[model samples]
Target: MTPGALAEGRPEARGPRFRVVVETGPDARQEIPLEGTLLVGTQVEGGLRLSDPTVSRVHLELQARPEGVRVRDVGSRNGTWSLGVRIHEVTLAGEARFTLGKTTLLVMPEPTEEAAEPAPRTTFGRALGQSAAMQKLFGVLERTARSSFSVLLLGETGTGKELLAEAIHRASPRSNQPFVIVDCGAVVPSLIESELFGHAKGAFTGAHADRRGHLVQADGGTVFLDEVGELPLELQPKLLRVLESGTVRRVGDNAAKDVDVRVVAATHRDLKAEVAAGRFRADLYYRLAVVPVRVPALRERAEDIPLLARHLFQQAGQPDFPLTEELVQRLMGYDWPGNVRELRNFVHRVLAAGDAELPDTRPVSAVTAAEDLSGLTFKEAKERMVEAFTREYLTALLARCGNNISEVARTAGLARSHVHGLLNRYGLKAGD
Candidate 1:
């Protein structure tokens, strides 16, 4: 049977709502809202049933508990694994990852509405946003910066996670102290250990003299671990130890010295899935994700696009560039898969082209749409036309309803699931 949504008689409400993300294997990229007790296997009657032969007929079970979700393996041919270790049962209070057969599943508590808070200022530190999502995030950041907890910034590429991390540091009490950034993905793996924990003289061929690592350099301050998911698996333990003990031991030296450092890690990867797949250490994941915050994708807050575009133009020294209503509409209609970075590149391209022949920013006219369909097979042309029409219709519908998915679904006479599928396919995100 094809994978689809499962409906179960509601049990007494227990714990917050949760969703399961199928990261790999069969049904990969599918998200299912989980409620009550969920029975997942290859041959289950109602709950999630996979088509993969590797998945046992009765592989695993998940029951929602008042505290959290309790997951158990029910004696399948292949056992269930969490944190790279086989387990009979485990209770996850927040976010957790586990694997059954060849599939990886990540269970996370669905976002809940919080109490009303103060209105968000249009600008927070270096970041800019006026959307409700941004305002809510600003409130969260305000609270996060007041403390010394290790923060994990999760988001898609080009969503300005690094900027948000720096903003948190600047707003925190550690503003006067050093704020060092360690590009975990850019660092040489062989030298990563020494680079993060410092190295003693003669520790390696390149160690001519003692050097302070990122942790030491940012003593009494904050260290932003950019692209932290790329950190080598072998080095995770050492980093965990530092976070736990507040001390670092230099390479080639036995002595350990104390350092006061706050950690703010940012990553575009699903670290939980990485842990469940054995590519990342579980202990370290817990240590870094003490307070996880997801940075909103650009499409999730399209109203900010015009504001961001003007900011970019001013930054590029092209403040005179005309940002007409048509241009704004065209910009807002795009999916912007690359987020802010893509928008910035687009502004630069327009600047480079010069105003003598400014690029067209108006909506696609019927004549232009027909021209775009030229030189294609009938089937291909039909598909292209359908895609374009669907995109335009959805874009206008979203604007009319203020980015409310439920309203859009009702207005279009489509199921919520169908609407959600369309949104994801078109790279659109409903407002929070």
Candidate 2:
């Protein structure tokens, strides 16, 4: 969904009384009368007690006036903002929006006698970055939204592939239709087919009644197949048939049922190598990859780390904790082996510890004691250090990519043969 589409709540009226709605947390909504001045802060007495630490005890004061509502910042650490610009005070002639720390406030002019219903909230809205990479991704999404061709999103885990899929759906003509998700990795192979193509009553031992699978259920809509690379080899042909014929044949049923579902698949694995390895079908790969889009890894966009960290910090309810330059530098220097997900977890750990000091990002060999290196020749020690770093790096890389050799190779920018050699040389299994 577009960022603007996330605006929530609306003005409410009770009988002859008018009130302005304030939405704080994800689903918390409150209505306050526009008859008197209201204080918003962390204090218990404030009309709106925002629990965020970035908010001062008396963060903002809003006074209702004949002309409009007057808003003044009451010395908040993070200050206040109107439409994205920082301001100490501003008068709203009518409706306006403002931000205090992590919270957003919408001031509605006194509601009329007839109250309009609030707009529906979108399933996806958070636009986390303004980096060039993100801008390019947005452009691709906008273009893909207008087409019915299948999409293949290539990215590391935690790169927000699912979120992008939702954005594409919300921007498409079928925005009002259902968007179904199928996690191929999580589904058991035995049940994968039945789950994607439903069965008739008594089709199998446990077939209790007739049911429509995700594809049929999502007819006229979109279906996101997450971790599509994990789909079983045996099932790949069936999926390809469905995509080709736009029909599905339920197990134990002869009749083929028509479906009109848009398919969007995502994976961290490199399907080209998978096909070469005889693990995935080349035809299915080509079908799903009509439009391939890559979500850039976090390390490739280090410039966006500060913005992402602050955004995540606010979401974690720790806006008061300063995101120091040292911490940001440390974060940027790290490879972010787990990408955005690891950074988020690191932020949570910092907030939980109530400290801004960041952990060391140095390689394990660099932290080894000098005494432990005694007696070894300089060349021998250097070789050992290189091996140590390589082993550690590959281990984390493999783990983050779900131990898929092709994915690890793609992420590491190494040849499939070279990666296989390294795995053998280091005596490291995919799962290791």
Candidate 3:
């Protein structure tokens, strides 16, 4: 059995902590203590009989193994028709369920408490990769959940921008409220203003009745303005005003109404260049980018491809199916310029194409495109990579010093300030 939902411990990385789920059997309810290893077995009217009675120093030793762990039959003259089974017996690593007689085991591993993080919804259409990048993305989602600031997501199309935006909304305090989504570029140029800011009755042709705008509908929650860079030049000021004043004015109405909503904007275009070209407003950019986050493209975070592919498949809502390691490897090696959204679509497409059969692997070809991206000029892939020496030195020092930067620096004949600067430069903090 694995473990259950848990808080992350240790500085696994500069990210969320994780735990695992393990199952003993059914009728074996137990909780993982905050400390110590978890054990589950039946209480024999007393405590465990062992040479070491170390329960005092232990955190928890909960065991309620099913009859499957020790199958036995009861005496009955009429005979009994009962089902007893023991389906799995693996050490704790991931979550799974096992059968044991009348009872079953449900093992769980909290690999990050990661399910809660929200992915930014993007206009991207392709996703590729399987590696640390996916983990990092989840970590980003976890971190974003702790704040309510306006988040500006930057990523190319097919990058799952909108997905992340919704994740943030769901993880936010306003999850229960309206999560209004609007495509700034999707609106026809002539109708963009009317669509975002509600139009009053008779405001314009086809304005038959008073209608609520996307901003107002998201009054108590979040407004995801995808492709925000496409917002018309004329509409920029009004949008900024609403962001600044928390008010949305209808087209035909002279008065403005107050609204309580968080604005999360996303666009692949470079806002800075857009501002310079007079295509985007600088003030609005500042207001919306209180927390600017760049969604790493598929190729950039390829390490997370396997996990993402698995998750995207699961997200398909299909029960009782798992992906194979071979398929996962093919996916992990791909270059996903499209990012997570692409991966989701690929999973959906694969499931639909082969009904989840392992043979049908068009998804593999889609990811092989990563090689294409990789072949591009070095300038094309502006990724930050640690030098081999720096990585080895840092790893060795931290391990030897028990992750103490001061101690490592002292032993290595380096100034603490320089070491701290290096750690900061490399995105390494204490514990990692």
Candidate 3 structure quality by residue, lDDT tens digits, 200-271:
999998999999888888898999998898788988988877876678889999989999988888987788
Could you tell me how far off, in angstroms, the CA of residue 58 lies in candidate 1 after the best superposition?
Answer: 31
lDDT of 1 by residue, 1-432 (tens): 000000111222234466776767878766675767888899998888787678899898987655768898988888889878997988876556788889988776543323224345977788899998888777767666767767788887778888899898998999999999998876778999998999999998989999998999999999999889888898887897798678999999999999999999988788889888988976676557756778888889999999999999999997877899998898888776557876776777678864322223335455246565678899998887788668767765564444556657755768779999998999877631
* Clashes in predicted model 1: 0
Superposed model 1: Cα runs more than 4 Å off = 1-118, 355-432
lDDT of each: 0.77, 0.73, 0.56
Each model's RMSD to truth, in Å?
A: 13.7, 22.9, 23.5
Q: In candidate 2, what are the lDDT values of residues 1-432, reduced to their tens digit?
A: 111111111222221221455545432345566557888888848386677676778888887764567889978888998867998888775445678777777665441212122222322245466666676566656656766757788988878898889888888899999899998876767988988998889997899998888888888899999989989999998998898678999987999999998889999888879987989976577667756778888888888788888889889987776766787787778777677776776676676775444434456666555337667999988887778778878877775665667767766878779999998999998743
User: Among these predicted structures, which one has the highest TM-score?
Assistant: 1
- Judge candidate 1 against the unseen true structure and give its global Cα lDDT, from 0 to 1: 0.77
User: What TM-score would you give candidate 1 relative to the actual structure?
Assistant: 0.59
